[model samples]
Target: MITGGTTVNGTGVFCACYIRQSRKKANKSEASPEDQRDKTKGYSDNEGHHFVDFYEDIGKSGYDPDAERKGFDRMMNDARAGRINMIVVHYASRFSRQNVNIVLMQVLELFQLGVRIVSVNEGEFTSNNVMDLMNIIMRFEAGHNESRNKSIAVRGTFEKARERGGWLGGLAPFGFEAYKAFVDGVEIQLLRPRKDESKVIKWCWETIKRHKDDTIKQGQRHPGSLAGLVHQMHVDKVPTRGARVGGAWKDALWEVTTLNRILRDPRIAGYMAEPYGNGKKAAYRIQRNADGTPKKYGYDPILEPAEWWELQAWLDSRGRGRGLTRGESLLSALRNPEDEPVLNCACDKSMCAYYGGGTSPSPLYRCNFRNVPGHNGNNTMVQHHLDEYVARRIFARISTAEEDGDTAGFLLEATKRFARTQEAPSNARERAQLVTERHEAAQHLKECEEDYKSVKDKGPATRRAVLEEMDAAETRLKTLDDALKALAAADAPALPIQQWINSEEGNGDPMGEGSWWATATLASKRRFVTLFVDRIVVYKSAMRGNRWVQYDASKRVSITFAGEGETEEASEAA
Candidate 1:
């Protein structure tokens, strides 16, 4: 192939070879980065172009155009800097397998700058001729179709593996180790409890359990406050479970959030969860069987299901007790409207609830910021009235949701759709299959359109056949397009708030099941209030129509509270 000092043909052509192989569950046996680089370099050498550099992204997908692929970014930078005249790859698919229009746009960007692309397998792709460019796009479309097919196939493989209790390979979670075992004479990887790591996991649970008991007996701190346990672990010098296999053990201090995550995970209760998608699109949901019980994958249990549920109870109870200040609020886990952090003043700072002062006695939320120099007025509102108003609104939303029957079914369907996307074809072979189908369908439609455009006065039967074929092909393309869109719009985990609303049996009104807001404990009320209400702007009027006259009993008070992203959160969570 491209040996040392082999190129001398294309005098002014500086070629940068691009190579990519997605890292998501890919094996070294499949088109390794080195092989791609070598093959691309050889093509450049044979073409007699100056092989300037190799731009490579190992284990990165070609589907996401905005993904931070280092090599791809560098290649673009070099092209912008005029460091290279030609971009070479084993195939144009190596450049991208995203939407055809998107890939064409990127190619046009370089084309405008006088840079050429060389797909070793397909030859040069240039905008020099309209026909040549269309041909190049056709080749790219084929690659795109292949990419989708491969993605579908990969997802199917994972789904099959999961169903058959296969490991579905990934990094072992906190107290577990991924081990290979022979099952029916075929080796399969699965998670097993690591003795040392398991001890740490047990310690976390045991410590919380002990605290739970202490709280029940003494009526003090709750077991869910994990920051103390985190501190204790640090004091005990417990090593963090970073990377288990071929990864160094870290001295990282554990956090309450980590404890929160661990306690919440169904895996701790001897279950398996398969993670799919990435970033904001990611959802690490429990893989369940048809019976709604968590699916098993040879995962060793860290805690009994009952104990795990108990742990979750403790974790969810954090920041919900007596003597909690406005600043110390719980904004997670609870579904009751009373648990949201809703108390705020017109000044934007948190309003402190205070008892009555001198003359007119009433419980009030006083704007603490009014004491500051720049602002004026002792802006205060009756806490009971504001709380009632906010609570009513929350219940109304819940009631509306209830009126829209079978929200659970809709949500379940959405979740299922999301799960499918998560399992989208991830490997080259499967991706090739999916994308190839689309490309063929696309090509068939392209041909039909071309034929339609080029048609002359022909026999009625032949013309009718062409028209029917074109309509069929168009329908097939639309179906494929819809499927791709479904894959791209991955589902997020259903938010707890929506789940709670669905679970509750309510009359779809404020005073119905939503009446729990009235009887909720102060701590729980504060927690719920924060979820939607931001601030209650209080205004005091001294007179009815005319004036700034001194008034006490005659003073009129009006309160308006802002809804702090409850709707947005509900939409996202759902």
Candidate 2:
């Protein structure tokens, strides 16, 4: 029997036995999930605790938070709601191997709720004992350290494998197959070209290379766009590689993203590389040898490097950086209801927004899908007057002092009332950390740039080294910037209206919320439009002459507000 004030002669105490296995492959050990479950059950039975439920997470990492683990989430919810008096895990690590902050927060919450935690191997954790709490934290730290060490080891092993030209074990790209080979009496995974699939890949490359110049000349017919080469391939019934499961393949359709990957992949040029980072910060380039040339692998080259690079250049030139951005006048929010995105062209393609070529230079949205078969009709719209009309309606919807002064005051009061109800120190710390890290990254990035600029008459090798360092610093700064943005998104607390407006630093206005809607940045207004407006549908009037004219009152457009689904119609004045 436990000596703490809490009762442990558990006749009525509900015990939630939790078990976790980090991998599908099981080792034959006493701590194995099955053995752990049996031991926990037996212990609960011996202690006379009422076994209410078992939460088992198989093939799930211990370090993942509750949101990622279904069983663990349900168990925590039950404990929080007082549905269970105690939680029993095979060991402390099974509860959590996360970093101290995350693990301690969950444990402290349970302790505060008068819930007991027990480990089958280590015994119960009594809330009143500081030593028990420290021991629990120490055990969790051990687990966390083990996980970190294992991760480092895995990365090192992978790096060595990369050096050896061995496959790092992921889904093979379209035209390749992962196969096992014995090299130096050790079995290693290697990628070899798939015969039937390789032919399709070669054709895609050849066709793309042949059309590269044409694509550059007329950006709309480019292979990078959906309605361009991808659509053409779909029409021609070109067989693309499919997903493989259990040594079986299923038919998959071609997509521009996948096709772009094939075109950009250096592996098709008989090289192997590894991806680093995630999202827009990700980098993938040719792996290099000691002599500074690309490392060659066993796979056969499907396309020449020169043609592959040319195709890549064409694709890069057509990207968003080279074109008219969304901030341009008159092209905002225009939509075609039949498109997959509904905001693009009817052919489910991006429309090139530009000023008209002739004297007037009015804003126009031109769909490049004219080159696509069955989509040869002109998909153009004049947007000169549409911009002002949309702006008027959107401005009306924005919370202004004139429209909802009372509601804004009420919201302020409500937020103040609820301000003290939930204060997350962890969130505050995380935000502060992000802010500090962002500043440091910016400072370091500036220093790197200065260093690069200051270097004079340097050797090619020295200059290259400095450039690489600058590039690394820039990449790190970008990563930190992304993280800060993400943190801000997650921590948008409902502060008072005045506080919300003044959150933007360096503003002189003491009470800016009154005029915030008007003075808001274009990016902010764009976000507001996205939130409040569902879609803007544009239509053309019957042409008086053979050629279509600029915007006039006859050209109809409708702005549909989001929640209420109310649509307001407007037209350009003749």
Candidate 3:
């Protein structure tokens, strides 16, 4: 009896057939988008309504917000524009499984716009009659409840499987393959190390540990450890896990980000990470027991706990003060000196590498803020000259300390200062407490959910209280998770000077030709500089010199070593 705008046929009502399939169907028995479309079309035909258009949202959740459901949004827009006066869906659930109140409001809006919604399984949804209104409310509430219960059940199943050391369904982590086997007469998926991939992982750990000692020839380039691994994998034609492309499986190229993820993933250490919910950021939070030790799976681990922690520590150390820099340069760490205050121009702004065209075409360290009005100073210094000056100063200081028999004290104080500036040493007791708090919060969340389900029909007030408790518990869990992640990322004790000395042995003197400095990679030299030097203040050139004359760096630069109160002028002679 509802009137509609005239269509091409000009007589009967124009109906838009809407179909939705939320998630892939597990089996053919479950209704698909095609099935929903057919049912809606048949009902439209039976009612003598013209099927003007079809709108389908395949593999889109009905509970998603209206903006996320593209087909549904288009259908509503068309109905509002009088292109169609009714939306015909296979069932009310196909239209929406949003909150009951939200769904009711949408339906009311449609009715006010002179449009109506018809569900083939249920009848025309109308607010005119009390019974019809009650039926509409019950239909949407039922759909919402069904989706919520399904989500809870699925999470519980995954958690139980995880606790039992079973691999939840997904592509296995790199360096491992998933296999199904019967455990006590029940088949479950499990992960096992893949031989070739495992070898690559082992090589990565070994290479990264010795990365600091890697040397580059005069013209050859070294991309440090993480990027170097990617290049080596490509050169060796190392195959990554195959992915399906256009119906055929293809191998992906090794990437720096992928390598980083593999190195950071706890699965390599024989533990599964907790599954995070949608919209939550993922972190490698290993499932742990009440005693705060990682829970093990039924497979061999590629890296021991100590090795994994060592790798993490190395990564944390590298991540700090990392930024874009021109090809292998000693002052790379000083490029962004906001945090360390190590390298500064006369104008107080951090100096950056500037490659410009002039009579002196080589790269120069120039103040980034020099071009601003009223900032007048000789802010540029030849890169090589400054680098040589700083390196000589460091070598002289080390040599002096060794002669004075104060090397041990100097190294100890320097290590402590570096550790303090870089990152706080992770507290074991604090980490354990955070892990325990997360466990308790998770348990409390489960209890709240169960209470909500049990008392849903009791009263609105009771349901709200339970939901509030669930939210609070979830917030607490998130906080604890973030704290645990911070603790994991905190730098391990800075590498001892003796370790550096040992690694650099058999090279030569610390300052002479063929020495550690001559062969050390740019990354290694940067680390060395950051560990020993606290700040370098550059002043305007004090002496007039021509291009033919050797610039006197001693008069223009001051070097401040870590744990030292006074800044020392650069030595006149190396």
Candidate 4:
């Protein structure tokens, strides 16, 4: 009989069996959960102990503290609650492979609670016996060391395989599938393009490219948004990867999130990516060489590196929180010289486009948040009026520069300023450092604002102090923003302004039908506006007549030209 104190129900020692198998050995034949449970049950029965229950943690890693082992926790809880006098396991390692010190503490805690731990192979452990304690400690140490060594060996093996372009055995990325191939006389898995999935990926890139080309060359707007792509795919009945449902494979529908993932994945460009951590929301960074180029696997690339980079640049230029929508109109890429969105309501929310119903003639830009409670601004303006007013102002500035024989110098300076707003830092290390600094600054500013809000009912002196802190944080953030802009400017590529200036269309009158401005693509017009304008601020119309009557652009609009400190009313009479 087992020599254990504190028997439950005054009958025999109540024992609970704990079984664990790490994910690495989950599929192995040896030391399975069932095998461990059977051995522990036989050992407990041989010792005349009553087996009350079994706690099994399958495919769980004992070494990782963050790994959730629900069964192990429940077993511990049962022991602490005096429900079980003994705990049985096939081996000490099956109970835990945590650090030796942690295991020792757990064993001591169990012993203090009058619970004894029994291992089928290692025998019983008692608090009074020095030999038993030492044996338990040594067993835990051995388990930990074994796991550590195996981890190191496995990591080294994976790294070497990655260096040699070998697939490390997991589901292949969306556009490809894994296939067995002979490498160095050894059969190994490699990625091969899956035709159906590859076609979807190719279609996405082609659509974006065509949309961009048409906007820059033919002044045509096309439906190329992520949402548009999803709609078209549904209409065309494009096949996504199938999922098994009730033993039958069912075709999955394409979604924006899925398409976004495909667009953002570096694997499509044939580069390996390293995950940040094991968290569910953890991001991945593309592995790069010393020269900052992405490290490529041996698989055939689905998209060219240049094409992928260009796509990324375009996406980034769209800014945060802006939904991927149709790339239409001249103001799609509109921003001030400082790179801030130019169209903001008096209530401080950014304006959005609103297409009127079939009865209306033109689209309108208005504050989408005007209907929200406590928001009072209802700023709305016709889209074409603003577009034409801005276009005319830009053309006049270019005409003045040309008349003064300073077109070359004027265009160069303007292009450089515009490029700074559009470009990002090229040096990866510098970019990462800037990003970290920006995040910290933003966090500090947020804390300051939260503190100010929390202490609003406090003394005036305290509120003032909090206000000062907030101002300081805002200043620091602004300084970081300026630094980022300067860094981007240093890395900005030269614009093709010289070629545009030399064309025959450039010499004609800008307001005339034959002028470059008249025929310039929407993308080109936006580029011109960004080069010459610092900001465009719109105010509510003051006309006392019907709201639908044509509003004067000069009365409601203010334009701040680049390199100017003063804002001027946008007027044709200027």
Candidate 5:
């Protein structure tokens, strides 16, 4: 059980703080996020308890602290490892508001296990006191009260912004900037156009419509109504409202967020939020699952139905049956004759047969799902002709750009290359060593637990030995696991990487090195391309003598082929 004291008699009491601020900071100011964080650091110093880490979700709205997964994960990790003997925060809501009962249970348990909590702005929570219990309850109540205040403040901000023009706390469209109204008024938005970006944006919608019209004329397929209107912002990639970093353009995909910003603005659409904020009706998500899953399509439609439909029609058209994009083309189907083998079939378990001229005509790699009987996926016979393509396309450019100054082509190619790679691990070895150490410490936690039982049952200086031994073991184990997991993942196959290198069509000019090609290794190059262009739909027939072959009419094989009809190209001559 926990004891009320200034200090605990334990050496490994891990200390952490959760830092948050309600105000948004777009620039450097005394009241900005950085300043607020510094304040917490100073406060921790004054309290005499050394906090080894902090969870900073500054500028992240306070009403829904649970949405900050990073903060939650760190807090949970602290609890599970028994490292945290204390959780410090400016206020209780700084941790969580919505799930008070659950959050309190977690924090209170940490106190019982010799951990303590202190809200620097609120008060210290000691398990023995009735005051601490009251403080927790009051803090939780304050969190909800604060939420109510924030909603009112937001409504007022929107009301004022709509009437007088200001920046409300909402995101802006892709090609716009949210500026403060007047010199120091509410936030407002201004149209920030890209270099011919507006024209291109509209043209993207037009291009889709044209493609759909052609399909309809061919009687090949029926197109959706909103075929041409592509959303500037969508679910997959909500545009970040800031300057582009590195060489990336546009920041994120055009999505509903972008569209909504455009439609809601009275500045661009010739009205403001003031009218709507004071209006009787309000909009909320129509369909939320009892368990919280949201239905995809949600619209509060400020604009007329006709205008919204036009936008939808534009989007539906662009997504019309796009035959596996150039990047997604398959190897057996790819037509370049100037490549070598890179990918091996999981079917054969090796590249010995398909490569090295064992087969007269190149054989595509087939999955052994059916043949092997128990594989991750069904026995999908996707083919791969990866002898040369991977080397030339995916990893080749990294070589050329590094050796020679071919920056333009390199970036474009690199984007396609990078799209295939997986997101990096949350805790890389170099980072968060404590997290790994704690996890390791946890593995051996059972050992300490046994020793702890021995001290209680067998009775006795032995306490130090048990606790110290368990702590050391757990820390070491975590470090080792972290090191192993940090090793870069083996390059895997991608649908686009294969198609890009294998096809004669899009394999941009020779990988130019001023003197010689040196950036990438033969193995790296091969692995890179094949990983992207994973599966190829192979349509083949038994060949006789390499001169000609009779057509097999029975087998109409179409794995991923999206075109209306298949044609016999000279490249695929049997």
Candidate 6:
């Protein structure tokens, strides 16, 4: 006996429709939410009454109804509050799984809560007396049919969308744009290379090919013009998404920074990448944290193996920012051992390059192989800082050991581990190991060379085979030379370890004149550190109280005091 329309605030009325679609319905080829929303809009017109706002929990699997989702709870609350007099649903199962029998509970609960209910798909409700087993069973069958039909439609939509590579929909990189293109469902369109930047990409590839010299530039000297080439794009009025982001040239264009995107674009190599960088090409830049330290390899690769090497060569030759390589690595350390080298790159390929050549210049090392974090971390150092970092670490360690009267023990242990010390095989073993590796290498080279010489130049393929053999022989010879050097041991202390370990500045100070310390070459001093300690990491000071940084690279410098037992990055995770 409802008279004036029941006040929906605390007295539930009009139908509340629940449109439960299959979980597989999400991204399925069936109709979109917008279209479904529109269809629901029509129901209000047909019924001639206002409805509670729709509650959508679209992609949820019905089996777990209380899986901490939003929207669904709000609907239930309104029902409990009697704010909704009637509940409308496209079907009963839309409210929950059939096995849970949620529809009967919702009906009984609303009735107890002082709310009346009406279902759009099911017939109007009556007194509890008439609603017998036969009626309830019929209603359940209707709901089951609706769920099945909806599932079929959704699956058809997804199968079509996936085949077309349509707009699955979400944000992508910075440069390219996205659009729609599927037929049965929503389609996705990806970025294609723009014309202007392609020319520049080609230029970079050509440069790498041009620089591939074995004897002429055997050891890898990065080319000098990589920066100029990137700049040239700007000079030629080449447009980039860089223009849109503003600080591009000054921002992304720098070496190992933005310029890498241009050179590494796979569009220049051949085809579109599986998923490319935002820039017109599928150029994947390495991932980094907000602070600029690399987090992992980039999602997309922008440079080619050859082009990347070329860029490294160019940066190596530059010596600093003016010629700084694109990313961090040990090359920087090699260029400026006085400065610390970057220790690692998180690139999956793991082989990071280093660069040096700046004021208070420091070398850097890190991998650029892949963009997966922790994946390529070894190829890429998780972190690196300051050029003298490793040296500083070793010196500091020795200083501590000297203070603790463990100087002798530290040096002895270090030499035993990494150098040819007394504990090492005596002169006889040293010479034997050296001669053995050398003999093997020499034999390998001779055999390869002989094979090459004996091969007749009967055809083009024969000549090519011989050339490959000769190249292999040369590589083997170089390996042999390096190995023999490693085996050669000199036991005589350049600076008597006992003196260095015993002096007042024992581990703290470098050798003094003939007074209390012996002399050693810079090479030897550096070698001493490497032979014992591994690496050191520098860090920004912490703001927390009484912060101390401890370096654990088995080495440290005593050039300055780190203060009362402070811990640095090295200590946090060495």
Q: What is the C-alpha lDDT of each candidate?
A: 0.59, 0.62, 0.69, 0.69, 0.43, 0.45
Candidate 1: tens digits of C-alpha lDDT, residues 5-119: 3332445888889988877445853466777888889988887877788888887888766677999988887777777878988877778888899888888999987789888
Query: What is the C-alpha lDDT profile of model 5 across 231-301, one tens digit per residue?
Result: 33332233344424323454544444444434333232122222222333421211222222222212222
What's the distance in Å from true for residue 258, model 5?
11
For candidate 6, the TM-score is 0.35
Instruction: Answer with 2 or 6, whichever has the higher lDDT.
Output: 2
The window of 10 residues in a row where model 1 has the poorest summed lDDT is 565-574
Worst 10 residues of 2 by lDDT: 333-342
lDDT of 2: 0.62
How would you encode candidate 2's per-residue C-alpha lDDT over 91-175 as one tens digit per residue?
8998988999888999999998778999988878978999999999999999989988988888887666676788886787767
Going through the candidates in the order shown, the clash numbers are 35, 1, 0, 0, 50, 91
* Candidate 4 Cα misplacement greater than 4 A, ranges: 1-11, 41-50, 178-196, 212-223, 235-253, 277-281, 317-350, 357-362, 371-375, 404-410, 413-535, 540-550, 560-574
Off by over 4 Å in 2: 1-11, 24-59, 63-81, 98-113, 120-149, 180-188, 210-251, 277-283, 288-293, 317-574
By summed lDDT, which 10 consecutive residues of candidate 6 come out lowest?
556-565
In terms of TM-score, the best-performing candidate is: 4
Tell me how candidate 4 scores on lDDT. Answer: 0.69
User: What TM-score fits each model?
Assistant: 0.47, 0.48, 0.65, 0.69, 0.36, 0.35
**For residues 1-574, what per-residue lDDT tens digits would candidate 3 score against the true structure?**
2234543335558888998887755355247777787888888888888778788787788875653788888888877777787888888898899899888878888877767778888998765777877888899999999988887987886666666777886887778888987775556788889887889899999877665344443334445567777898788887777642212437567787778878877788776665443432444566655433457776778986556765665565454233334444578444221245477665555666666745567777777564443245346788898898888777666655656664555555565545545553356556545755565466567756877889979988888877877787788778888886666556646544343443244553565555667777777678678767878877766555587986778887887676564677644311
Writing each residue's lDDT as its tens digit, candidate 6 over 239-300 gives 55545456524344334345565444333332233343464444333222332222322223
lDDT of 2 at 330: 34
Q: How do these models rank on lDDT, best leading? A: 3, 4, 2, 1, 6, 5
C-alpha lDDT of residue 453 in model 2: 77
Residue 373 displacement in candidate 6 (angstroms) = 30
Question: Looking at candidate 2, what is the lDDT of residue 539?
Answer: 44
Every model's Cα RMSD, please? 17.8, 22.8, 9.7, 10.4, 24.6, 19.1
